[model samples]
Target: MTTALDTTDRRARQVRQALWIGFALQLAVALVPLIDLVTFDSITEHVRAAYPDWSADDVALDRNAITWSLVGIGALGCVGWLIALALAKRPTASRITVTALFALGLVTSLTLLSMGGEGYDLVVPLAHGLFTLLPLLAGLTAVVAVWQRRR
Candidate 1:
């Protein structure tokens, strides 16, 4: 039969597994921005199509800014995931940290997504925007797993 200690251990193991999965998801999403940075010509085309009136230099500047911003944000998210993983043994701390990070990530993604006129346009390519939002899935999973009740 299962005792309280057994349940606690099982939950901790579940939380650890979820944290690892979240880290993997965060890493994968982070790489998407790096890929975008490497193949930036596609980003330039998208930016030019979105803003036809912009000059070549303007397009280049905008593409660079968007790509770099995504890369930076992705890196930050990966770091946050690592921190959450480290705190997994401390259930309260881990849950709070993961939940806070998830909220911050969600806000940042929404803000990035609403970067154009009327606050409803994607500043980056649709794929980039979607990729940026992908880490939230990881964050959500981690948050849920960490906060699961002792049942």
Candidate 2:
């Protein structure tokens, strides 16, 4: 038989685990962009190979824009994740973080969809989309779990 205190402690543990999962998802989101930036040359080379008519200057310009955009987004994600980590002990603040992550995911998805076929190849775009989506799902789950346990 579980007492109210036992149930509360169990729920608290679940929330903490969920929050950690959220942090990990955000960390992955943050790293993906940084990885893209670091591997820009390789990626561009592949892109150029795919489209033989694209000039080096054109590829460089496009790659630059994409890399910078990714860095900016990733930086924001890192900050948000860090804040969420800091707020793990505060359920309300943690819920806010989840909300923020959902917003970020929506924005990223819209931007990517609007870009169409211009910037990156299919794989990069798909990967970015997945990165955003996975974190959003994690955030949503954590938020729901936290909400259910609110007293």
Candidate 3:
């Protein structure tokens, strides 16, 4: 009962949905870093507690640097996802956007994983681990869904 055009429309809709979900996930990832920027004092306290010998001043500085880095990266992710969302209707642009998002997701995830030992604090580790995995899942899903569609 479904014409070719109907099938195409369905696939397009699915791709659009996937891209938007990916955008939302990326937005969540972006917000997590902003949250860190605001609650960094608690993180510093955790780090200071874990490393007694480390000065509070030093811990605070390190925490600030980490939080800033995350914020910057997260902002970049938001931009990438926004671009992808905007281009979702154009097959080539969509593919490029999807690929870029996947690459960013991979880099971001790996970077977060590499910082696993730095979590020192329970909250830090948990937040970092969860955010890292989430982006990877969302990016992969978006890429696969888009890739499988007929252009």
Candidate 4:
């Protein structure tokens, strides 16, 4: 019953919704702790438990670094999300914003992977994986959706 125009409109709406959900989910992960019990205990607690050989002090130190890094990562994503939300109507800005997010995601992913368990089940490494991949995925999705919209 839908015309091509209707279908295209639907697709555009879906793309916007995807960006919104991605933005919200990412913002929650970066800005809030203890949501869905995804707190400091989420991954680090596991690593700390598995590595009794290290002091609680060692775990605490690493936790600080991870937390701050995630915060920075989250801030950049937030900016990109805002840009996408505001300028999705404008393909040029949307593309640039999404590209920035993708670059940031790439750097974060590689650095986290490199830092994983060089000395330690690498259990906490899971956090690094999540932190690395989530934004990367979101960014990639944003870029693709916007590019498609331009067509």
Candidate 5:
């Protein structure tokens, strides 16, 4: 017969598994920004198109800044995921951290999305915007998995 201990152990295993899956997804998403950095030359035209008034040197500087910003954001997100994973055995702490991270990700993504052609006058390439938002999936999964009630 299945005892409460057995059920709790199974649930803990499931939570850890879910945390690992979230970490994997987060790591994969983190690479997207690095890939963009590797192919920085290809994005120059898009940046130029967005800010036609900017000089060649200006464009280069802006592109570098944008790419690096995305990379930094991705790296920080990966770190947060790792922290959540590390705390997975402590379900309350893990859930709280994951939920907070998810909220932060949502806010960051939305802020980035709203930051173009208006007050900020910064136009990010479509790929960059998407890259910024991709971590939400990872964060969301972790949040849901950790917060799920024991069955």
Candidate 6:
């Protein structure tokens, strides 16, 4: 009997696929945080009316953090994202970068919420952040292990 392919190679190929998928997920979220800038002020006004305890400073700080995060992490992480797909032999580095980027995304999201954003409750945004985080952590570790073994 003959196998269709090398199991190890097939696994590496799977790892490659996962790496790309994780990259894709993060890519998709590139716009999630931006919604704040366009709608935050209006939302915060309503929130303030509904909940008097909410502060104006919270809105600006949250808005600024999330917006900055969208720009910085979303933009800067592109290189790492490309590397995850394009690197022939540096999947480890790619994965590490991907992990870091996802982590950054999560932190950014948390920062946006914790800093106090009356614009919106963090439940939805935090949910999205978790979705992005899972793949990044899992795929990055897999990619790194595979690359390390490959070498």
Best TM-score among the predictions, by candidate number:
1
Query: How high a TM-score does candidate 3 get?
Result: 0.77
16-128, model 4: which lDDT tens digit per residue?
77678778767865764333236446545654665667787887676666566666666776777776778766657766766766676677667656554655545235655
Candidate 6 lDDT tens digits, 1-151: 4344465466567666766766665565565556645755443443455456757786556446545665566555555556655653455565565456556655755564454344455523444445445445545554454544421
Could you report the Cα RMSD, in angstroms, for every candidate shown? 2.3, 3.6, 3.4, 4.1, 2.6, 5.7
In candidate 3 the C-alpha lDDT for residue 140 amounts to: 77
**Which candidate leads the pack in lDDT?**
1
Candidate 6 clashes between residue pairs 3 or more apart in a chain or in different chains: none
Q: What is the lDDT of residue 134 in candidate 5?
A: 61
What tens-digit string does per-residue lDDT give for candidate 1 at 1-151? 8887888788778777776776677677667766766766677777878888889998889888877887787778788888887888898898889899889989988877766742226676777777677767767777777788876
- Misplaced by over 4 Å in model 4 are 1-12, 31-54, 116-124, 149-151
* Count of backbone clashes, every candidate in sequence: 0, 0, 0, 0, 0, 0
Clashing pairs in model 3, backbone N/Cα/C closer than 3 A: none
Estimated TM-score for each candidate: 0.85, 0.70, 0.77, 0.65, 0.81, 0.52
lDDT-wise, the better of 3 and 4 is 3
Return the lDDT, model 4, position 8: 61
Q: Would you give me the overall lDDT of model 5?
A: 0.70
Q: For model 3, how many clashes?
A: 0
C-alpha lDDT of all candidate models, in order: 0.77, 0.65, 0.69, 0.63, 0.70, 0.54
Put the candidates in TM-score order, highest first.
1, 5, 3, 2, 4, 6
lDDT-wise, the better of 5 and 6 is 5
Candidate 5 C-alpha lDDT tens digits along 1-151: 8887777677667766766766666666667656766775645676777777889998888777776776677677778778877887887788788788789878877776667763234566665676666657656666666777756
lDDT of 4 at 137: 66
- Model 3 agreement with the true structure over 1-151: per-residue lDDT tens digits: 7787787677668777776676677677767766765766555655677667877688877677666666677677778777877888887888887897788679766666655454353434455546756766767777877777444
In angstroms, what RMSD does candidate 4 have relative to the true structure?
4.1
TM-score winner, 3 or 5: 5
